[model samples]
Target: MTERIGIVGGGIVGIAIARALTARGVGEVTVLEKERRLAAHQTGHNSGVVHAGLYYAPGSLKAQLCAAGRVLIREFCQEKGLPYREVGKLVVAVDDTELPALAEIERRSIANKVPRLARIDDPAHLRDIEPHVAGVAAVHSPETAVVDYASITEAMAQDVRAAGGTILLGHGVTEITVDGDTVRVATDASEHEFTRLVVCAGLQSDIVAKLVGADPSPKILPFRGEYWALSPDRTDLVSGMIYPVPDPRFPFLGVHFTRGVYDDVHVGPNAVPALAREGYGWLTISPKDTWESLRWPGAWPLAKRHWRMGVDEISASLVKRLYFGKARRFVPELRMADLEAKTASGVRAQAWGRDGSLLDDFAVDRIGPVTVLRNAPSPAATSSIAIAEHVLQHHLDLAAT
Candidate 1:
């Protein structure tokens, strides 16, 4: 219990782990964050949807962890007096062509035991849930909710501090050295050693993995998702959250409408390749990052596999008309002008293998006393607490309870 434990990345998942450790009297916990604050990257940038385990494969880590984490997040929010809204989500199929995919989603939702899952075939019934939405069929997840993840992470950090854990901001890990049973981590400002180490470095996960001499096979491919905010006056177009049946070929949930915790609706997060790991816009580029991705063995193969989708997504990013067209599919009432502007963008740290396939499930790797989270996308924030317990129990061989 006295052993010093270090956690890299001050995102929700990392802080959740720290809180678990300190709360259980597991160790002398220390959290090192690169930025001067926590939740600076993907955690802060994502649409704050507390998912209801709808899309993941049955029995997968994402499905299991997300189901468990959703309850924990809601309970945590309630305990901390944070904002948590169960606004519900409806995944609609616009026509007969999309019915098969919508059925698959329903199958997955049922198999995953998503709470209060329902399938609606009548257009009038769908309209009862979302008056503006026009679809022939849909799978509704009434338990799907929204919350401010950054605020939740801050609350988790508070718990860690309250439990005697140290959280060091502005401590971006530069080097990691493992010797026998101890791991030493170095930052620009200071250095520390720990009896156990956990890496939850979201966007930079693969980069950090290499620091500990782990395999570079699963490279982090930064994919930028751009969102357009709905006009404030027109936010009423979306009742809760409206989604398309995801393209299953890729991991990303395509363009959709989500009414946030604060009651503001945002639409469209079309995925595109990011030139820099942290790049939010097209103008921001990192030559080194771009070159590294281009040279990866998976790059060419992935490009060949998804060139059409790449073209469509890139065109949508460049042309407002195209993006609006995609968004207006479910809501025929949407106008080109209803999409105010590009409100915010987040880069997904999509983990890819040398064979050029995206890793759909959560992935973790171990090198001695160090445990690294390599691929954690969309549901990561939703699954943060459960992921912490999972990592502790499986990779570190520490029972969280």
Candidate 2:
């Protein structure tokens, strides 16, 4: 008898898994999404950059999967005739102080075997790469590119449908229970019974995991990343993606400039502790979400440790000039006037431990037939395909089973 599989969350990761399972003839695959459409949350609001395994640590899942996923996504885009542009990326160091961090990043990139990675030290050559960028030195990854992840998610959903899977939108999973060998998933609209279940609830991962009696130590803390698009006339200032050498203390890549697939330029995405789990703006508050985050055992200590950075982030969110000044460090020509209108913002579903440490790698928890993706941010979109494969091979242990 074929096993029935149920996947919660219609984001790229869940959709990719559904597609992978259906293609492998694993079982009947049904995807449950709370929203009316797929990719409504993190997957939709992302910067759309296909990461080249430059920043991840060597031999890590992120490093392995990102390198592999970039190839897969490129091939998938080519095969599907989707837009995949190798616009390249520059991880810039504005002064001598940042060079050490930049060098460490280059070392990791080399260890990860990122294709066509080059170091640019001469200011003249840096100008040749990014004409307006004011960085003293940089590491260029020519293979870094951008694409519409929502489009990719939709295409994967199409593949799932074509392979005899079902996608149920507007079905928010409220609970999950085990009954002997079968798993029952309860949504607001209905209950689904399946032999196996996978929960990829991005922002609400921890909440969903608890429904199935999973540990809640690593709680989800939403970090809202606000963005500003450049005026149409100023879009020419950035030919490709320009990023800062990420601070070793934090996971955020810092504010930078990026040219989208549609030829528009955007700046920022300053990381600030969100008021709620899905909070996109200062006014969008959720009392329950706020309470949960604050009440977490780890929240206080974590805040105490990073209070200064947190203050800076929140200040930048409130002060447009301060936010613009960050990007202006590398893009000297970028003026406060160049910031056009506010664009759609994204909330990263970052997981934090009770010990006040942030969870760095992709975390998967297997409880019987239920597999929960606890923490998958940033490169998760880039690593969706490979993540699906890894889930199948390791988490689900399909072959052994």
RMSD in order of candidates: 1.0, 0.9
Stretches of candidate 2 above 4 Å error? none
Clashing pairs in 2: none
C-alpha RMSD in Å of predicted model 2 compared with the true structure: 0.9
C-alpha TM-score for every candidate: 0.99, 0.99
Q: For model 1, name the residue pairs that clash.
A: none
Clashes of each: 0, 0
The residue-by-residue lDDT of candidate 2 on 1-401, one tens digit each, is: 67899999999999999998999988789999999999999999989999999999899898999999999999999999999999999999999999999999999999999999999999899889899988789999998999999999999999999999999999999879988779998899998899999999999999999999999969998999999999999898998999999999899999988899989888978899888887789999999999999999889988998899999989888988889889899888888999987787999999999987999999999999999999999899999999999999999878654
Candidate 2 has an lDDT of 0.92
Q: Candidate 1 at 387: error in angstroms?
A: 0.6
